[model samples]
Each structure stands twice: as C-alpha cells, then as structure tokens.
Target: MPHVSLHTPIGDVTVFEHDGAIVALDWGWVEDQAQTALLDRARQQLDAYFDGALRTFDLPLAPVGTPYRRAVWDALCTIPYGETRTYIDIARIAGGSPRSVGQANGRNPIPLIIPCHRVVATGHLGGYSGGEGLPTKRWLLALEQPEGALL
Candidate 1:
C-alpha cells in the first residue's frame, strides 16, 4: 500500500492506494509514508475539493465492504454535492433500514470521496468519523452548503 498525508482545512488527511486504486482515507498523518501516481492524484483532488474547486472526484476507489454495504456506499455517491439525504432516503435506495444504512455509512473507508458526510438524520445532522465528530460533520456540510442556505 502506498499513502500520503496532506494538510487540509479539516486537518491532516491521509489517502491510501492499494493495487493501484484508492482504497482508504483517514483523519491524521501517518509515518512510514509512501506515494504513487494514483495517491498523488487523490491528494490533488482532495486539495482541489478543499479549495471548493472540484465538485466531483474522478479517481478510482476500491472501498472494502459487504454487498449491502457496498450498495449503501454506492448510494452515497449518488448524493449530489451541496445537498444532503436522510439515512431513510438511502435505505430506500439500498434496501435496508435507516439504522443499517447508518452503520454502513459509518464504515465507509473513503469518507469524503464516497461522500458519506452527505447523509444525515431525517431532520438532524447525523454522526461522523474523524477527530471532531458532529462538529466535523457540520463543517463538511457547511463547506458544501451554499452561503444563503442554513447549515
């Protein structure tokens, strides 16, 4: 596996590539660092994303999950930027309960790239990973949200 860590507005983010495609993204810097062309591309895309310049990611992703979990993650990618969907909404698409959808969302290996941050409770901001928890979720949502829209 080859990985690289870069500083972003949310803090340090590390991206990992395995067998030539992006496989995971994490919240902090990691030592024993390595990089590949694919990792480099992922980092560039992430940087552009943080700058509000890239709306969609073009890198290949290979997040590990069960079939149902993969479906949940796939549905997450369907969520457009600057918008959000409820766990129930995704459950409807992925064929499960909101709790199940939430579980899979939490397990997403490639968070921002998979756009797991776009899912929320029916009328509330939902949980998130990374160091800051709900505040981190809020920040990601705020980043995608238009200035006039309430976060």
Candidate 2:
C-alpha cells in the first residue's frame, strides 16, 4: 500500500492507495508515507475539490466492503455535487432501510470522493464519521453550496 498526506482547509488528510486504486482517505498525517502517481493525482483532485474548482472526481476507487455496502456507496456516488439526498433516498436506490444505508455510509472508506457527505437526514444534517465529524460535514456541504445559497 502507498499513501500520501496533504494539508487541507478542514485538516490534514492522508490518501491511501492499494493495488493502483484509491482505497482510503483518512484524517491526519501518517509518518510512513509512500508517494505514487495515483496518490499524487488524488492529492491534486482533492486540492481542486477543496478549492471549489472541481465538481467530480476521476479516479479509480477500490473500497473494501460487502456487496450491500458497495451498493450503498454506489448510490452515494450518484448524488450530484452541490446537491443532497436523504438516507431514505439512498435506501430506495440501494435496496436497504434508512438505517442500513446510514450504517454503510458511516463505513465508507473513501469519504469525499464517494461523496458520503452529500447524504443527509431527511430534515437535517446527519452524523458524519470523517474529519472533525459534523463540523467537517457542514464545511463540505457549505463548500458545495452555490453562492447565495443556504444549506
């Protein structure tokens, strides 16, 4: 596995690569760093995303998970940038209950690229397990929010 750490507005994040595909994006820096072309590209994409210059990610992702969880993550990816969907909405698409969808969302290995933050509760912001938790989720949603728009 190869990984690279970079600084971002929210905090320091390390992108992990396994078998040439992005495997995880973890919070904070890791002492053991291995730079690869894919990791460098991932960093560039992440930088563009944080700068609000990129709306979609073009990278190969290989998150390790069960089939149902993969379905949930795939559904999460369908959520467009600057838009949000409810757990129920994902459940409808992924063939699971809202709770199950949320569970899978929490376990997502690749967070920002998978766009898990785009999935919110029906009437409110949901729990987030990445970065600094809810604050990070709020920041990400705000970043995606169009100018003069309220999230």
Candidate 3:
C-alpha cells in the first residue's frame, strides 16, 4: 500500500492506495511511505480540494464494503457540493434506513472523495469522522457554501 499525507485546513489527510485505486483517506501522516504516481495525483487533487480550487474529485476509488454499503456510498457521490441530503433521502435511493445509511457513512474508508459528509440528519448538521467531528463537518459544508447562497 502506498499512502500520501496532506496537511489540510481541517487536518492532516492521508490517502491510502491499494491495487491502483484509492482505498482509504485517514487522518495523520506516514513517514517512510511508499509513493506512487497514483498517490502523487491523489495528493495534487486533495491539495486542490483544500485550496477550494476543486469541488468534485476525479479519482479511481474502490472502497471495501458490502454490497449494501457500496450502494450507500455510491449514492453519497451524487450529492453536489454545497448541497446536502438527509439520511432519509439516501435511504430511499440506496435501499436502507436512515440509521443504516449513517452506519454505512461511518464505515466509509475513502470518505472525503466519497463525499459522505454531504449526508446529514434531517435539519441537522449530522456526525463527521474528521476534524474533531461536527465542527469539521460544519467547516466542510461552509467551504462549499457559496457567498450569499444562504437564504
């Protein structure tokens, strides 16, 4: 596995590569890492994302999960930047309950790229697995919110 660590505004995000696709994005850095062209590209994209130069990620992703969870994660990808969907919305699309969607979201290995943070509780900020939890989720949503886009 080759991994690249980036220091973003939220925190250090390290993307792990396996079998030529992004497998995970965790917090923190890895010293004496195995670097690859794929990893280098992922690093560039993540840099662009943190800089707000990129909203959607275009990378090869193969997150390990069950079929049901895969569907949930795939549904997460459809959520546009700055926009949000309730767990109920995903439940309808992905064939699971709100609790199941949230659980799947929690288990997502490649989170940021998968855009799991876009899934929220009804009228609530919801939970986040990064940047000290909900604050990080808020920061990410705020990052995507356009100026005056607010009502």
Candidate 4:
C-alpha cells in the first residue's frame, strides 16, 4: 500500500491506495509517506475539492466492507454536493434501518470522497467519525453550501 498525506482546511488528510485503487482516507499525517501517480491524482482532486473548484470526485475507490455496508456507502455517494440526506433516506435506499445506515456511515473508510458528511440525522446534523468529528463535518457541509448562503 502507498499513502500520501496533505494539508486541507479541516486538518491533515492521508489517502491510502491498495491494488491501484483508493482504499482509505484518514485524518492526520503519516510518518512515512509513499507517493504514487494515483496518490498524486487523489491529492490533486482533494485539493480542488477543498478549494471549491471541484464538486465530484473522479477516482477509483475500493473501500473494504461487507455487502450491506457497501450498499450504504453507494447510497451515500448518491447524495449530491451541497445537499444533505437523512439517515432514514439512506436506509430506504440501502435496505436497512436508520441506525444501521448510521453505523455504516460511521464506518466508511473514505469519508470525504464517499461523501459521508452529506448524510444527516433528521432535523439535525449527525455524528461524524472523521477529522475533528462534528466540527469537521460542519466545515465540510459548509464548504459545499451555495455561495453567500448562511452556515
């Protein structure tokens, strides 16, 4: 596996590659960095995303998870940038309960790329397991918000 870490608005993010596909993205920098063409592209895309120049990611993602979790993650990806969906909405799409959908969301290995922050609880923001937790999630959601909109 090769990994590259880069600075972002929220914090340091490290992207991991396995078998030529992006496997995971974690908060904080890694001590030993391994750069590859794929990793470089992922970094560039992430930079563009944080800069608000890119709305969609164009990378191969191979997040390891169970079938159900994969289904949940696929549903998460359907959530458009700058928009949000309730956990119940994901459950409806993924054939699971709200709680199960939330669990899968929390377990997502690729947070920003998978767009897990776009999944919210009904009437409120939900728990986030990446970066600085709720604050990071809030920042990500705000980043995608339409310009001039209130955060």
Can you write out model 3's per-residue Cα lDDT over 63-103, one digit (the tens) per residue? 99999999999999999988999999999999979999999
Question: After superposition, which runs of candidate 4 have C-alpha atoms over 4 Å from their true positions?
Answer: none
lDDT by residue (tens digit), candidate 1, 59-144: 99889989999999999999999999999999999999999999999899999999999999987888887648888888888888
Clashing pairs in 4: none
Model 1 CA deviation exceeding 4 Å by range: none
TM-score of each model, paired residue for residue: 0.96, 0.98, 0.95, 0.98
| Deviation of model 2 at 89, angstroms | 0.5
Displacement of residue 33 (Cα, Å) in model 4 is 1.2
- How much does candidate 4 score in TM-score? 0.98
lDDT tens per residue, model 2, 1-119:
79999999999999999999999999999988999999999999999999999999999999999999999999998899999999999999999899999999999999999999999
| Model 2 misplacement above 4 A | none
Whichever of 1 and 4 has more lDDT, that candidate is: 4
Report the lDDT tens digits of candidate 4 across residue range 29-59: 9978999999999999999999999999999
Preferred candidate (TM-score higher): 1 or 4: 4
Pairs with steric clashes in candidate 3 = none
Model 1: lowest-lDDT 10 consecutive positions: 122-131
